[model samples]
Target: MSSPVKQTLKWAQKLLPACDGDLNHAKRQLVWLKEKIISDRPGGAIDDKLSEQEQTQLEKYINQRVFDHKPLQYILGTQPFCDLDIVTRPPILIPRWETEEWTYKVIQLMHQHLDKSRPLRILDICTGSGCIALALAKHLPKDSAQIIGLDISNKAISLANHNLNIHKLSIRNTVEFREKDVFNLDLKEPVDMIVSNPPYITHDEYNSLDPDVKEWEDPRALVADEQGTRIHKRIIQVAKHCRPYNNDLPRLIMEVGGTHQIKPLTEEMQINGLKDIEVWKDLADKDRVIVAH
Candidate 1:
């Protein structure tokens, strides 16, 4: 009842259960194998340099790792975020749906704040993979927006640079990446808005996360101290430092974990003099983002 290719995939699937390994991992490996076979077909005028035996060995090699828990994103060396393909390596957090939503919302808010004739400045903190900054730079009205992305990790900044180059979104004059800790950033000019999806998962929550995530994603990017309010507190504190001298303070938009995280962070923002603080819900109607003036 099964074609030869289908049978080959079945054997690989049986050898590696979807629960035991990532379901997507098995599927990707099969795709790679099929491509190789297709490209090497006889009389297709392609080099059959890899003999049939060698091809079989390559599939087995990929299958063995799929049988393990290696993340498919890491295996593929890339992930999709907000219509962009981003490079992902170890030590950089993979951008998630919530992060993209937060970034998109910031863009929407910025459009409301700045009219077509005025240019707006935006800052993105803890910019792993440069997803937030790059997405904003790519989508915002090119003539009226500037974006800066900052990350503590040098590796992350490097990857961000690569991605910017890849997308040709490098308005080298307008978009920039910097190596700096969120807690210690000092901007020369006041920005119109600051956005971040900082590390907010508590230690207990980190430990309880799905093994697929806990085992593969960067641990440092996921865990935070003091019920996951530590980084959130620091970002709010820095915003207080950057508050404009006159009436306007840069608006803040941050992605928090959920409703459970709303109260403590709201209180912290108020204590730091961040007025008009409010929590925004994600698509699921859970409290997923916080906004303050």
Candidate 2:
């Protein structure tokens, strides 16, 4: 008498014992099985009858994938970021709550600096699924904010565009996605602020990450050289390039890997002559975000 999803969940519990170490894998399997079975319902309706044979086949396929360590977000192709549903895939890093926290801080700072009458232009570097840019566009004053999201990966750009359309936000036009390396970017117009959650995990530490992450998430998006601040250093250097063109210095808000990264990053900021450098801690009291003028 149980629904198909309920039956699938029960089956997952039984078959996932061998994979007991990976609870995320087991949970993903359950969700995938439910979605697959529901999608196959007659007339695309969940109320439509599902034959016993159809349910059995779906459970088999889902169990196999789950045991293999594939991520649930990769299977579902969507993740939630600050109330926005974002499209995701293999090459992009799944949106994390820490990134959302830093993004909100950037928006708050933007409100203080940008004038009420003029439109505020913001740039998000290393944009994975366009979550930061899209979230800002959705929350900021519509009449005075414009956002642009840039990623080096074409796949990431496409996925971000897809999320923008799915949300049905008119900010799509204002929030453009492009495949451009943060190191080589040449900005024509001066942006009010530039924010990024660039790769800050050291290569050594990256190699030691949990299997679920190293196996499923994009490695490039997670790992970096020079103790994980290589990309962050590049972003700081590039911001200087924009200073000559725009009379006003742009503020930078970056999410760091850990408190250890603060020293190296602060030195980089000093070498680049950036002002007002400070570290912002997350709710956990760890220095997670770096803000500078």
Q: What lDDT tens digits, residue by residue, belong to model 2 across residues 1-293? A: 88767765676675575356465666666655667667766668774344777667665666545565665566666777877878878868999878888777666765565565567667889988899989888767666667788988888899888887877554532688889998788878877677899988988898788665788788888988888999999988866544321323356778999988999889888898887788889888888988777
| Model 1, span 198-270: residue lDDT tens | 8899898887786657777777788889888788888888776554423333468888987788899889999
Candidate 1: residue 228 lDDT (0-100):
86
TM-score for predicted model 1 compared with the true structure: 0.81
What is each predicted model's overall lDDT from 0 to 1? Answer: 0.74, 0.76
Error of 2 at 282 (Å): 2.4
| Model 1 CA lDDT for position 231 | 88
Q: Report lDDT (Cα) of residue 122, candidate 1.
A: 72
Give TM-scores for every candidate, taking all chains together and pairing residue i with residue i. Answer: 0.81, 0.83
